[model samples]
Every structure is written in C-alpha cells, then in structure tokens.
Target: MWGYMRPIKKAVFPVAGLGTRFLPATKVVPKELLAIIDRPLLQYAVDEAIEAGIEQFIFVTGRGKGAIEDYFDMAFELETTQIGRGKDISALHGTRMQPGQAVFLRQQEPLGLGHAIWCARHIVGDEPFAVLLPDEFMYGSPGCLAQMVAAYERLGGNLLCTLEIPIDQTSSYGVVDPGERHGAVVEIKGLVEKPAPGTAPSNLILPGRYILQPEIMQVLGRQEKGAGGEIQLTDAMAALIGSQPFNGLTFAGQRFDCGSKAGFIEANLALALDREDIGDHILAYAADLIATIQKGRGLSRDVA
Candidate 1:
C-alpha cells in the first residue's frame, strides 16, 4: 500500500541560531546541545524524525556549531573505553548515524529560519521534507513528528503542527487563518507570522514541526524579510497557501519551548518527573517546595 504523496525521507534541522536567549552558556555551547533529561535537545528532535520514517538528516549549521557535528559522529575512544570496561553501550546507539545518512550544510550568515532551510535545497532535491525545530521539545506517546507524518500520509500536503494559544498570545507565534476543521486537521486559509495581537486571524499557532513541499524553496529563494529583518519561514510558507494543499494538524502532545530560560527549565523538570528512575523523588521534592511556598504565603497574609 503506497501513498500518493512522496515519502518523507529527509528531515531538516535548522541549528544555526546563536541562541542569544541562553546567553553565556550558549556563548560556549550551542543551545541545541543543551539536554532535556539525558538526551540533548537536538537528539530528541532527531529521534522524533527517525520515528517518523525520516532517513536522511540534514543539519543546517553555522560557525561554532561544530559540537553538533561531533555529537552525531562516532566517538571512538569513548566506545573503546565502554567496550573495555564491559559497560552497556546502548546509550551510544542513538548518537551514531549511518554513513551518508547525515549531511551538514553551513548557513554562512545569521539569516533566519527561511534561509536556514533554503540552504538544504540541493540535498532535499524536489522531495517533501520535514522541518523539526529542536528548541520546541515535544513530549507525546508516538512523538510529534510521527503524529505529523501520520497526518501527512492521510492528507498529503503541507502540514504544520499547530496548537491553539490564547488570542492575546497569538502575537508571539505564527497565527493561522483557518478555513475549515476536519477533526484534528484544519484548512489553512492563510498564515500570518506574529500578527499584531488584536489583528490575528485565529488563535491557532504553528509551533515548529512542519511537512513542507519543495516548492516552498522556490518561494523562499526570492522571499523578502518579514516580521523581523531576517527571512522568515512563515513568510515563505504563507506565500504557498492558496497554491498548495496547505493544512494544519493539531498534534496531541505537550510542546516545551526550550528556547526560553523558563521553558528550558520547565522541559527538564517535566520530562524528569515522568522518568521511571527519578519521577517519585522529583514529585516529592516538588510537593515539598509547593507546600513551603504556600506556607510562606500564609504567614505573609497572617502578618498583614
């Protein structure tokens, strides 16, 4: 049983951002290398892509992102040490990518998401590809990208994993002008990148995961800067709205915006609290912390 849509074989990870939000830590280490539980953020995104049947991994990186390249490569000395010590090497399995399976392209300038994706055009080569942003760490049963792939199989068009945000918060996200809703999938009438608060078309926002057709590359090639002074992917995607079968799939998952400091901490705690090895302990500590805070607030109220 083959689907009419070309199989999504490649996934693009735009890891070129300088991560200014992460500050000093990011100054030394690329933000994508930051960990949630035991896995680096990028690993989580890559794992999601792999789970979604993605074969080729395209990493659009910039200077100072060498660590990401090394992280995916085989660590010979570490593997040798683990072998000599007879330690379980299961942890190393995910880090190693098969030869020719991974390719890294340099995004020479600090452009934007659109330019970062455009950099992968040559390798993508007329195939429908997936774009997974590592900063948006999603925790779901089958993974967010897997869910989107399932939708893509049924819908067979450009699909953006979407979530309904408060109307006021729509200014922070790429707001979707929705047309019709067919269960979880919604027809995208238009896409507005960070629309002004009261002017947003809808409350639904594109969170990060996307299944885009190759024609978007052509749209982005001559695309002008939008929202910010950089070439925004939202603008390029918006240009293809009426021309293509554009839709939004509202995925069932908890998306953590690891790009922000608060969100990063929240992701770590949330994932950690779900782990078998440390869930109980973390839960207990959290309970105690909440109690202490509540007690302090009570005392303050009594004094007042």
Candidate 2:
C-alpha cells in the first residue's frame, strides 16, 4: 500500500469483451449499447462511476466498438431535432463528458479481464482507481461503485463488490476465502477464479465492481494465462493477498449479469416493473401473459 492514499478519481471500464452470448445483435451494436428500458447498459455504469466521485473515465475498448466513442461525443443533429420538437433533453445531460474526461484505448487482443484492465494502466497512473463492468448491471441507490468506494475509504485497501452465491454457482465466479466480516464488508484471505464443483473455499465471490490499487496493474503485467488461457484479473488480485490490504464489500444493490440474454430481459423487466410510471401497467400485462400461457397449456392437455 502507498504511504499516503489517493482518492479514486479515475475509473476503468473493460468493454473489450466479444459479448459472444448476445451474438447477431452484438454483431453490429455493442451489447453495452443495448438499452435497459431507455438508458444503455454502458450509461448506467458510467452514472454509477460518476456518483462515486470519478473524474476521468478510461474505456478499454476492442475492435468495432467506435459506436461507444461516438455515443459520448456531441450529437449536434439529435440536439437540434429535440430542440425543434420542444423536448426536454434532461435525460441526455449525464451522457455528456467534459474535455479530457474520457479516454478510450484499444485492447488489441481478446485476452481476459486482467489484460483489458492492464491496458488502462497509463491513464490510471499511480492512484487508486475503479473498474466497472457494464455487463454486470447493478440497481439501487448509492450504486455499486459508490458503496465499494465508501468501504475502501474505511478499510484503506483494495475492495471488490462481493456476493455470496450458491455453492453450485461457485464455479462461475471468483470465489473468496473468507477471513472475517462486519456488516456487508468481508475480510478475504484468498481468491480462486472459477473453482470446480466442491473445490471452492467459499461461496462469496467478486461481482465485477472493484476499487484496486495501481500496483495491481503491475501484477497483471506479469500474470500468465490462467483458467481459460487468458490473463485472469483474479490471478493478479489473489497475488496481492499477503502484500496489501484487501477486503470484499457485499454491495447493497440488486445485480444482473446483463451479458446473458435472460439477465438482460430480466433487468429490463425488473426495472420497468419498479418504475412509478409503468410498474402497475407492466404488472397487469405480465399477469395477463402468464394467465394466457397457463390457459394455452390447459388447452394442450385437454387435446392430449
């Protein structure tokens, strides 16, 4: 750990993933641009970072992701059209970035999360920085990053957005070896990425939001390919166990793995159903749809 800590002012977004799960839709549009109700998945993550006091954004982008860059730039024509229609463009306010606030870099290879984060090392410099994965959609107040930043301030070390998953699901995440806990904060002694069934140390796992020391970028620099022949961020983080202050914060929020189609649909439905403007409407529609499906199943049984 540094003798004096620097407040996290920068955040890195690793958006280089191929998003293979979304397929043909992702072929032309980045899955990050896919709207949740109305706001794109990427917008939510950026908003979360901003709420956490982030001043600069480092987006580690991949090939064919220019649309993301364009999205943040001034949309002159759109602004003019909205003005002409006398529409309040307040919804578009948070999407604007000040000069030098955002820097996008290319991840030349399809390496793992570790490598993608490593790509932003230069922009991140030597301060503590945040990493937000847009694919992991977080819902609720204070946001995921804001909660982690608060925990990091109290603990003064690296902190991850942690969750206690079912034992069978341990293989799908970076499982943590628990050491202690206070409220939503958990002290972690070890981390294992995607452990096999029955081999994980604990069900608690990292869930794509992090406040990491700059030293981790160096750890990632030397990290070899782990589980999937790609540099795993968990590998570098696990190496920091004994050398630095580390803990996990079980964030207060609902999370969705928007990388998957099911999760994407679920996020939209959940958010829509919670909206004051549309909640009751959607609830009735959903109930009616379920009734229709059940009645159709009953008709099929009668025919059989």
Highest-TM-score candidate: 2
Write the residue-wise lDDT of candidate 1 on 48-124 in tens digits: 99999999999999999999999999999999999999999998899999999999999999888999999999999
156-209, model 2: which lDDT tens digit per residue?
Answer: 888888987789988989999989888888888999999999999988988899
* Local distance difference test, each candidate: 0.91, 0.90
Best by lDDT: 1
Q: Looking at candidate 1, what is the lDDT of residue 155?
A: 84
Candidate 1, residue 233: how far the Cα is off, in Å: 1.1
In model 1, the clashing pairs are: none
Per-structure clash totals for the candidates: 0, 0
**Candidate no. 1 TM-score:** 0.95
Candidate 2 stretches with Cα past 4 Å from truth are 1-3, 297-304
304 Cα displacement, candidate 2 (Å): 27
**Candidate 2 overall Cα lDDT vs. reference?**
0.90
